[model samples]
Target: MSDRDTTSLLTPELEPQMDSLNPEPAPRPSRPRQMTLNMGPQHPSTHGVLRVVLELDGENIVSARPDIGYLHTGIEKECEVKTWQQVVTLTDRVDYLSNLANNLVYALTVEKLIGDIEIPSKAQWLRVMMCELSRLNSHLVWLGTHAIDIGAMSVFFYCFREREDILRILEMFSGQRMMTSYIRIGGVALEPPRGWREAVGKFLKQFPSKVDEYDELLENNPIWLNRTKGVGFISLEDMLDLGVTGPMLRGAGLKLDVRKTEPYSSYEKFDFDVPVYTDNDVYSRYRVRLDEMRQSTRIIKQALEGMPEGPWQADAPKIVLPEREKMKTQMEALIYHFKIVTEGFRVPAGEAFQAVESPRGEIAYYIVSNGTTRPYRVFMRTPSFGNLQSLGTLLEGRLLADSIAALGSMDFVLGDVDR
Candidate 1:
């Protein structure tokens, strides 16, 4: 019952072994420290049903992956089933904003396959004018939406107000605003509607002032400048490697425009400068597109002033739709019209690719015909799909808040991307 007896009892019998009670701790599995976020298949800022899988570390993006196909319409395969002329309608849906550009490219491709069918000077000039107008329509939408995304609400209103004028002009010509389908294979759908000159001329006259208004609102605004000026930069080399085109490419100081370089639909005859900037940021893109709108206005003005006097459509009676007046009076015209409506005109066995400068960039159609009424193969090289390739390069290493500005600068249409 002394100290030795008490210590021996406590040490041997009463004490618990800590080592036996608890086992060794397991190590955590190796993984990245970044947080993953799915920005959208529904996010308004993503610009469409595009889902971006973002890997972020403390609000800085580590990497970004864009998920598409939500807007896919199987348009290429659908083109195979449609007749030569009927495919024009399908082209309209591919790039809804630049539907006329799509129409012209498809028409030009088909015309190349058909061989040596001359498009009249008047038709060529008209195509130039309409496509320029379509370019204005697209740039306006981009400006409004992009400005609003950056918290410049008033710029959006100003842009859309002018956009309404362009839409009215389109409606006057084609009887539809967005998807005109007015540019047919051989020529336009209808004779230029009455007062088209006055309407288009009026719009062109006032459009430069409207662009100046947008510049006044956004070009010098501190918030707009801070949000966009130094943000969303991708290298010219990266853009070229990734097939980026349009304002995004031009903003990087590359003077590549399909209208200027390739020259389809009489674009060569109309003179306009391709806007280029060396900044390669969202602000540069905005400036490039704005300048493009001004250039489009200039081309449209030239087209209106110097519209040639000739047949509106080509001389190919079989390929071009007969006039309503001619169809009523002549048996041959009536029969040809009936045959064309029921059985589409045959294109010679060949393959052709035509590229046009769409609002977003170089939009091309590669079509193959096997001496059939329908296309054997139809493939589109859409600008949105190309421009979207730069998203990862633009978003990575940048703050998450800047992603919206980066996305807006690309100006990609979901239909154009997923088609």
Candidate 2:
């Protein structure tokens, strides 16, 4: 009985042909045409040199991989070579958008190690003000570039218009624009300019209206709505998985903010709001940043009103550079300066991780000291680096063209990532 159909298992085509006498042609399998696209490391919308390789079928993206490190400058490794104090200059280049914030975090880390050096209350307040203002500047650049990418050109101009003022204020305090490097290890690199109060006040007075302009221009514009609303959408679950933070995560309705959750640099003294949103899309992100500027303004105003009166640097002359005036008259001051410049200060053996809410997200410094002038390892957990991790995830299944707005909204700075 088992041998009845044994020939049916024969692995011969000719033997099977006998069963049908004429075999119908086998059904052909369907294969969708694959379209490979290269969205550049040089493209304007990418915000920096980031090339993304994408596979698409029709308007849907099948897969995407972000190719970065195009702007690699080895800043992190270079820190090992620079002096603990000299490293401030290099910090400005990291998130170029939030240079002062970078300067503050690093300087503060090393400062904390210095023995019993008193950081004046005024200096701390100024630091908080500067850090918040830097956050606004960073968000401004992001909004302008991001809006331009999504076809909102006017918002770009309006955003930069205000950012120019912020840059001027930073320059007034530090003698430089984007790379202030003003926040020193002990305190600030320079004293606040005489008219800084009026200058910053005038700018703040006009800045709120400018934010409103951005809202009016893009908030309700039909084109802006169609392009951004519900686009480049991400969820809190995905954001948490990808380690996303900052406005992007908050826009997804997570009320987590480093400044509020983990206050630093006297941030707890400031009274302000942390804007949140339930729609984690380009439009909502725009709203979040726009409103964040308002919050930043409130902090700055309070800081200006309560501007403390004291020395800007830590009282330790051994670690902090003495003022040029004091160095000329005082022998002890001159010797301290000479020693710091020639031999450097000795940091105790320890490891500490310090995080600040940078413009893009959390900018953290993981510094290890081996009781020497040089750090054993200094790792920067740049916000852009963390934000960049969400790129592929946010970009998957999106339209090929939507990548521009999506990436723009991510506000990734290659320098931040490659570092």
Estimated TM-score per prediction?
A: 0.92, 0.91
- Scored by lDDT, the top model is 1
**Model 2: CA > 4 A from native:** 1-29
Residue pairs that clash (backbone atoms under 3 angstroms), model 2: none
- Residue-level lDDT of model 1, residues 1-419, one tens digit each, is 35554435446533444334446634546887789999999998777789999999978999999999999989999999999999999999999988999999999999999997999999999998999889999999889988888898888889889989989999999899998999999888888888999998899789899999998898789999999998999889999999998888899999999888877777888888998999989999999999999888899999999999978999988989898999999999999999899998999998999888899999989998999999999999999999898899889999999999999999999999999
Residue 65, candidate 1: alpha-carbon lDDT: 96
Q: Ten residues in a row with the worst lDDT in model 2?
A: 20-29
Total backbone clashes of candidate 2, pairs 3 or more residues apart or in separate chains: 0
Candidate 1 global CA lDDT score: 0.90
Candidate 1: residue 234 Cα off by (Å):
0.8
Per-residue lDDT, model 1, residue 365, is 91
lDDT of candidate 2 over 263-311, digit per residue (tens): 8888888899999988889878878888899999999999999999988
C-alpha RMSD of candidate 2: 7.4
